[model samples]
Target: MPPEDEPKVEIKLCSENDLVLLNKAIPEPGYHERRFASQQDGKASYLLAWQNGVPVGHLLIKWEGSGPQVNKYLPDTPELNAIGVWPPKNRSKGIGGQLIEKAEGMAKEKGFKQVALAVEIDNSRAKELYEKLGYMDWGHGEYIDEWVEKGDDGEETQHKDPCYYLVKNLE
Candidate 1:
């Protein structure tokens, strides 16, 4: 549960123009900026949850499925990826759930019949959240999740992690 003074959270789709402002709200550097750029380029979409005008939560809507992060097993299924809530203390307060619901609404609006996502096999907390929200583990499969981080010198470093895929029907 959040503290009594925590501000009410507002969830909405992020536009390209909101990138700069949203980046400021995220304490971590580069992460939100990369997501914002992806959204701006139409490669992905995001639902940002703001509390007191600061982004405290976010969920990424990926129409392309998981790509290298997971196999293209469900090619037609849009994915809800990178769901997060800020300031560890702010978790379990319904903010993540609200962001997920908003992402589902967006997916339905886009004409998708269902949605998919991958969770690290060890992340029971996140898996539980998704399960509570109606996502189901179809089964376990291995995939090399990939990511790239840019250094201050403008060089990119790549990394990969293994994960399991999950799915949910929006119908």
Candidate 2:
């Protein structure tokens, strides 16, 4: 159980099995698998957000120079690589925001001067959440080239930009 006021949200250090669970929570195809592979082969710090033994969110963090897909928006290093709350279970429960808060605190404790993350400009929910949490809009708009498309067989097709970049600096 977590301390009082923390809402008992259990955050777990990710393992391979948890990868499947995380993938189910996130809509992005192959993202969890890729992150898991990266972590397995010596890579980033990954976290899975769970509530009462049920995985509801996913948070994958990697340094800016280390290779976040949206590194172009980051200033220096250590960006929050990926964050997503399972749609049906998300419901403004503050799960994603709490994970971000935890991420910032962890980064600060590690002597990091700053942390960063890029949200899709079109994702008003994410953008609003970041802004409310004190994440300032820093860089201008930009888009990533590798696009992901849904195929007829429910497969993902890598193509071009799907959304605009909206970076926020963690202070």
Candidate 3:
């Protein structure tokens, strides 16, 4: 059902070298290493999408909630964090959806009946895509999305955004 010229996409768990490769391609600096450490610690899983042997997209599945609301409400639900397709040219073309589908399957395999993720309030494109894949607004109010950004000066700055959670049942 795909065009003949469409590049085949393969999804796999991120390895240490693959983490380095993806960092080189996307220049996320320490982000990948941090996620990789989480993966090593059994706290998360980092998945990468490859096109023609090049890393094109990534998704992180946290085994437990990282926020107060999520911890209070969806305590056992694994969270899908930081799902993205890179290079600007890879937008659409179903790559992002494929990564999500893979994440859903993984969650199901792990015996989880539900999965959750948060979307920036303004990210309608991603919200629409998630809805298409059966995710629904979690109805809980917004929470502050938090992360750290390391600067060229080797200093880390905390960043926050307003986001709300969404959930999907795997049953």
Candidate whose lDDT is highest: 3
**Cα lDDT, all candidates:** 0.79, 0.66, 0.87
lDDT of 1 by residue, 20-111 (tens): 77767666567777777788788798788888777788888887777744444565787788898887888888888888888888889988
Query: What lDDT tens digits, residue by residue, belong to model 3 across residues 111-161?
Result: 999998989989999999999889988877886789888976779899898
What would you estimate as the lDDT of candidate 1? 0.79
Full candidate order by lDDT, most accurate first? 3, 1, 2
- Residues 1-171, candidate 2: write the lDDT tens digits: 133545467777689877666656564666667777766765566777888767777777675433455445454657676687776546477788778878777777777766766666568887788778776654555545454666547787776544444444444
Instruction: Supply the TM-score for candidate 2.
Output: 0.73
Error of 3 at 40 (Å): 0.4
Question: Measured by C-alpha RMSD in angstroms, how accurate is candidate 2?
Answer: 4.2
- TM-score of every model versus the real structure: 0.85, 0.73, 0.93
Query: What are the runs in model 3 whose C-alpha is more than 4 Å off?
Result: 1-6
